[model samples]
Target: NQFKAMMDSANKYNVKVIVDVLPNHTAIDHTAVLPALDEAVGGHDKLYHANGFTPIKDYNDRYQCTTGEMGGLPDVNTENPDFQHYYMTYVNDLLSLGVRGFRYDTAKHIGLPSDPLDSLAARNNFWDVATGREEVKGLRLAVPADSLFIYGEVLQDKNVKESEYAEYMDLTASAYGHALRTVLDKADFNADSLLNWHHPVDGKHLVTWVESHDTYANEHESAGLTDEQIRMGWVFLTARQNGTPLFFSRPAGSTRENYWGNNRVGARGNDEFKHPEVVAVNKFRRSMSGQPETIATADNGAVIVVSRGNAGAAIINLSSEPRNINGVDTTLPDGDYTDAVYGSSFKVNSGKLSGQLDPLTSYLLYR
Candidate 1:
């Protein structure tokens, strides 16, 4: 009943829920893990790896890395047909409860039996089975075609390519957040450099965030993103032409107590829900979702101007001092415009939008 109530509220608010699935390993005490361990010691019908090899440190060895125990959690031998059936049954039950999406946790660890290197082919190879399509004609009957959204926690790096998993689901752009944190700390942060940085995947297929659960709980203070900087990142993340942005809500007392423990809750605050600046920017992004982007970075990347194909322009000043950005190609009809965030009016002349950015502030301007 509570689940139904939650889903009803989400539907009322046009929110899509993505469930997290952990298919790599079972808890040390989980029923499946216990049985598997029992089978390993007595019977041959084991669900887990018996006599597990040396704990896998580097995940480069795709085969052993996926099958080996992680932190003593019993690694599920996903290659086994029996395990796949049991896993999908659990997933289908959730599907029947009206879930439409999934976020596969440690998806890269769910390896196919055929690939030795955890190649792109192997990494993306198990969706058919894992998604319940391997045995069924079209996933669960409750799942409608083209309605299921899935993403994975495939943390991207030089060794791990986020693009390889795009076909399955959007991969978290962890590096993108790190890059944003790095530049936001600079006294002369260049807006142009931000524009020129290589994105891991196409915007549509990337899940962009300023902070994730891991980062928020573990690295918030250490990451050096002040509250103001985090808010600025939120504005940019939401206003971008590509990617879906997720906002991280910092617990109220966590800031004061400096507690970064996982899944622990602090007092709730009304500020995140009622913040006017954040509310205004979300509206701006919602209204300008399909517009093309024209970017111009100047002042050695200190001031970056963006025109969203006549929909609007965003002027960002990353520096500590106030900055006046001029000669920005707005790509809009010459006319008067106002910043949606700050509510300041300005004039556009000859397609050039001129504006002043306050210290460490951004202007979300539009007609």
Candidate 2:
């Protein structure tokens, strides 16, 4: 009932919900795979890999990576036709309940048809069937393939077929996130340093983030980032015209001093998503969709400017002190503009923008 209510509320707001679907493995004792349940379901031998609970010793070995246990959880035999049908049916059930898309967790652990390291038993057309590119015998989805938003967590690694995965759905741009984080840590706004996406596919087929749940909660790699730093990175990412940018909300009540305040599992996180700068940049992104993006630096590379064609620009000041934008090159048409978030005034004249930005702040200016 709670899930239904959430879906209903999301629909009322015209928001699309993408639920996380673990295609790699389930709990070691997941009810469906238990002895009694497996027997009742006619003992579908291919439901899980024969490797059982054996831990994968070498992740680079494609067979063990795809079939053996990950973190002690039993890996699913994705190559099995019966498992494919059952998983597709499970996805269909979610779609029937108003889920518009899915985030396939540990997608790289699932074998690709082109992976040479896996034996014939480990290869499958699971991606094709899941995305409705190839039809399953009796499986149907409540939502069509064209209407659903799908992305896979195909973390980049040796033998990971990213381009093949892109043929099925968007893949997370983990390298790009790392680059942004590096830039944030160094307070360097070098346009050349941050421009490369480091992906095999185009940006449209990539999901980018300033930080992810794994970066923060699991490894604590991004836990050191303050809310301000994250907001700055987000402004630069969201203002771009390419990849879909995702914002990770920290634990509820979390602060610089208290990293895990109110860290109840499954509870809603902090409200930084509604921050004025974030809201402004999101609006700018939506309003300027399809516009070409240009990156530039001002204030001795302390201020980074991301301009979307002639529509608008996101100017981010990454330094500790205020900076003056004096005749910075821009694509915005000549006109007077005001920051959407803070109402700061800016002017574009003769193909250049000039404005005063506060320390560690961002301005969204649009015509």
Candidate 3:
């Protein structure tokens, strides 16, 4: 009832909800694996892979990665016909409840149809069934597959099948996030170094992020990043014309001094999502859609400017000291403009943009 009410509210506001679906494994105590519910999907024996609880010894081994247990959770036999039907029915249930999209968790661990490491009986058609490419009789999505926003957490690995995953849905651009973090740490905003997504598939088929939950919680890879650093990264990525940018909200009451405030797991994060600069950049992204992007760096790589054709420009200064942006090149037309976020003034003359940025500040200038 609570979830339904939330979905109803989201629908009233025209917001689409993307639920996370775990396709790789299930909790050890999941009710679906119990004897009573297990029978519906060909009993417990057929529901899980034959590997039992064997932890994966080598992730590079595609067979083990797909079939073996991960983090002590039992791997589902996604290739099983009965389980496939049951899973599809589960997905249809979510769709019926107003889940317009799904983010497949541990998607890379799921085997692709072309994976030669697994035998024919072990090869799964889960992607095809979920995406409506291959339909199951009496099991259909409540909404059209094209209308759903599907993406997968296919973290980059030596054996990752990124192109194959892109064929089905958008894949997360993990490498690009790492690259952006490196540039931020070095305080070097080189356009050439920062612009490359480094993904095998086209940028449109990738989901970009500055920092993800995994980066913050699991490995603490991005846990040390200050909110300001994240904001700068968000502005740069969101201003681009390619992949969908995801903004990760940090934990509530958390700060650089206190990493985990309130220590509340699964609770809503801090209010960084509604920061004025973030809101402006999000609006700028939507307004500048379809416009070509041009990137330039100045002030010894302290400041980076992203121009969206003649529509708008995003100026981000990463340095702690105030920097003077002098004669930076941009695609914005020659005109005087005021910052949409900070009210700072800037001028574009003969394709050259000049502006003054306060310490660690950003400017969103639009026509």
Candidate 4:
């Protein structure tokens, strides 16, 4: 009934809802956990770490990463063929229920088939076994082949690599957030750094976000950027040329719990789409989809003009003082234009645009 209601709302809004799943670990009291415990090693491949794999001693050991328990939750042995088929059954059920997309949580913990560190090499890669071409072909027999979309929560740092999972699906560009926070702290939210973020994979294969559920509850890292500053950050994220942008909506007036963190949802708020800038920029993004960016930077990199394939241009100001964005190559016809967000008017002269960008504000200009 809950899923039906959700589907109803999704249909009403003409949107597709993606569900997040924890494929790596399960609760301590899960049904499969107890049964696996009593079964002899290798007797029941459904058990946790059922391959008779020993404990991983080194923190960075590849074997340990794949087989180790994540925080205390019993980790599933994705390498087990029985387990692979078992998990796919659940996925197939969800597919039958009209689930169009999936978000694989903690995907890095699962082992790749034929890992150099694994003592056993026969285990099939979890994704390949569960959702690769063969599995997807079977799924397509039941539904449209292009209907199912999947992305993984493969967070990348110095140790974790995103290229490993590039074959399966897009990955979350976690570094995009960290890098934005860095420049926002320095009071120079330059778009160049973000546009040229050094990631192992190309921008097309990544999903970017300004913040997530976890970041909101943890104040130390993002608290430096105030709510207004955060909104400014959003302009940088959504107005950019590459990668899909995700907008995370947190409860209003919510703070981190002292010990538990943001473990629970706070008071529900409708502030996410209520802001005028967000509304206008979202419309511009839709209109400018698939457009290449022509960047023009000025004011010592404090101001930028992102021209989107001649469809429109986004003029952004990163500093606190209002400055005139002069001689910006918007690539728009020489005519009058209005800022979609602020309603400020400007005239294009000789294929160039000049306007006074308000302090820490953005202007979406369209013909």
Candidate 5:
């Protein structure tokens, strides 16, 4: 029933749909494979990569190294032919289903080269190659080419280098860029002189975000900021330009658990389309913003806004209070622009414009 409902729900919308391919390991009880325990590991060859070690207490060994989180879940060895055969078949199933792309969860831990491939290597990296072109080519009988938009979940990098994950996928987002939460925590919320990390998106791939389904749902979640701060953050995350946008779904909160929904804004009290905070954010984002665009930064420090063809803009304030967006001395043509605080409204003027946004709120301008 659930699968049928999902398939039905998918057909109801014309937008492309995707599935998350978690590579690090299978869930503790996932039926994808059987216990490498008593069986000969048949019927699910790609699910296990024999490391040539018996007793095999766990699947993380030479062929498959675990991500250190111990449990019943066994990891797959991307380098193992047996595992490749298993996984490629799985990938083919989805492509045949007309699914648009894939979002790889924890792609870093599964590949054979755990040594951290360089930028050049990451770009040239290909799952199709590792699985063998012949295997991929043969799949033409089942899956079509140019059928997937693959990306990954790379949580953190202590070094803070952009180029590392930049070369690897078509679209990527970060849980690290929490402008929404940051602004909510601020007292003044000045976006001026704030260095917003939004520009590198349109021309290159970017997966930018604040929270996700996995984000904290307990009352203690949005630390350091106020409700208002988180609200503004949602304004930016949804409506910002470049890269694909992700909706955060936390089941246990005010209707809008994440940016994709309205737990933050409370549907502007009326719960209709125009009043709530996020509705304003959502409409603007949908109208504008596509991949392969770049951001415009006033300098490295004061203010930075990510934009894609004036479709959407995320203006952030890096300070404790409201910051003024100065370098943006230019005014946009008059039209209905979406405000993070206020819902959609026509831009009253075209002169150098400045508005006082809370610390955590990002003002989106959509024409």
Candidate 6:
């Protein structure tokens, strides 16, 4: 019933739901978990990598790679077969709701199992949704394996290895891709070199972003990035390659409009969403979406560069002040073009061009 209700809401707004699966601990009120906590609880040891001390509510993500802490939600013992089965069953109902993809909230909290067993359990449950999660049980069904999609909330865990992640899904966890977030949030660190930290080409796929619900929730300072800054942040994400880059909720300047139902909660009157500038972002995304993985990268403001699958080529400026530093490298049909970020175009005659970029702006011109 709740799954149906959730799907109904998602359908209304074209959104997705990520059913939380706590493989380490269950809710404090969970009757099934009472016996485990009180009696001689057996199993679930591997699923719950408890420290020598009792577990706390929120696991610190800044350290101890591959671990996270949800708000007071008890971690589930992912290693326990019973818990796994229960999770699978829950997935069945969720799938029946016509769910498209998943956002594994607080992925690090999972008592990550050994090898493919844990990984397979986590993903198989998702695909087995059609048969009410019976793939792992008696009368296994040949569920359409590729139906369900999975994306993880890896958060700040940087050390989550790609090799380990690739075992489970194709588009996998962000390789601690929070570097983009760090650059956007940390004002002092918003320099050009920050782009170097983007980890898109890892063994698994990754789509980058500048902000999200996690960024805006608690830390007020981190929540609201400026319009220009947000656009600039997305310019890289929308234009770059890797995983299916899930964009923001609202467009630029639309945040003040509350497009995402910000006024719903009777909270301290906290209401706002991303602005409508995302329109431009979607335009860029639409143009580049699965478009042969063209790429451009620059470090330390040296150059703003790009390539259309090593075919089309481009180079722009990232410095605060423009300078005509020659030594052009491009594969464009030698001619002229315009810069998207700065607005004024350029000439690519003889495979050479010079241009200027406004502060915090970029350029994308190709053949």
Model number with the top TM-score: 3
* Predicted candidate 1 versus true structure: per-residue lDDT over 1-367, tens digit per residue: 7877887788888887778888767676546445554443343335555423337777776655666676667665565545555667777777776678888887766654344532212232355676544563233434642578777877664455455556556767777777776666664445224553355677687777877767765645324566567676777777778877877776544453454323344445325545666787788787888998777766766766667888777777767788777776678779877887777766789988776778767777776
> How well does candidate 2 score on lDDT at residue 259?
82
Error of 4 at 323 (Å): 2.5
Roughly what TM-score does model 6 have, to 2 decimal places?
Answer: 0.61
Per-prediction TM-score, please?
A: 0.82, 0.93, 0.95, 0.84, 0.62, 0.61
* Per-residue lDDT of candidate 6, residues 138-208 (tens digit): 43323343565665555444444433433344333233335554554443234434434344445225535
Order of quality (lDDT): 3, 2, 4, 1, 5, 6
216, model 3: CA deviation in Å? Answer: 1.1
Candidate 1 clashes between residue pairs 3 or more apart in a chain or in different chains: 190-301, 190-302, 191-301, 203-243
Comparing 4 and 5 on lDDT, the stronger one: 4
Better of 2 and 3 by lDDT: 3
Pick the winner on lDDT between candidates 3 and 6: 3
Query: Which parts of model 5 have CA positions greater than 4 angstroms off?
Result: 1-5, 29-72, 112-126, 129-137, 140-147, 158-168, 175-180, 187-203, 213-227, 254-275, 290-330, 334-350, 354-367
Best by lDDT: 3
Clashes of 6: 29
Point out where model 6 deviates above 4 Å: 1-53, 56-71, 80-82, 115-134, 139-145, 156-162, 170-178, 181-204, 218-221, 248-277, 289-305, 309-331, 338-344, 353-367
Candidate with the larger TM-score of 4 and 6 = 4
**lDDT measured at residue 247 in model 5 versus the true structure, 0 to 100:** 48
What's the distance in Å from true for residue 70, model 5? 5.2
Q: Write the per-residue lDDT of candidate 3 for residues 229-343, one digit (tens) a residue.
A: 8999999999999999988888899877777786676688899999999999999999999999999999888899999998899999988888877799998888899999978
Task: Report the CA-based lDDT of candidate 4 relative to the real structure.
Answer: 0.69
lDDT, candidate 5, equals 0.47
Which candidate model has the greater TM-score, 4 or 5?
Answer: 4
Q: Report the lDDT of model 3 for residue 34.
A: 61
Better of 1 and 2 by TM-score: 2
Which runs in model 2 stand beyond 4 Å of their true positions? 30-41, 116-123
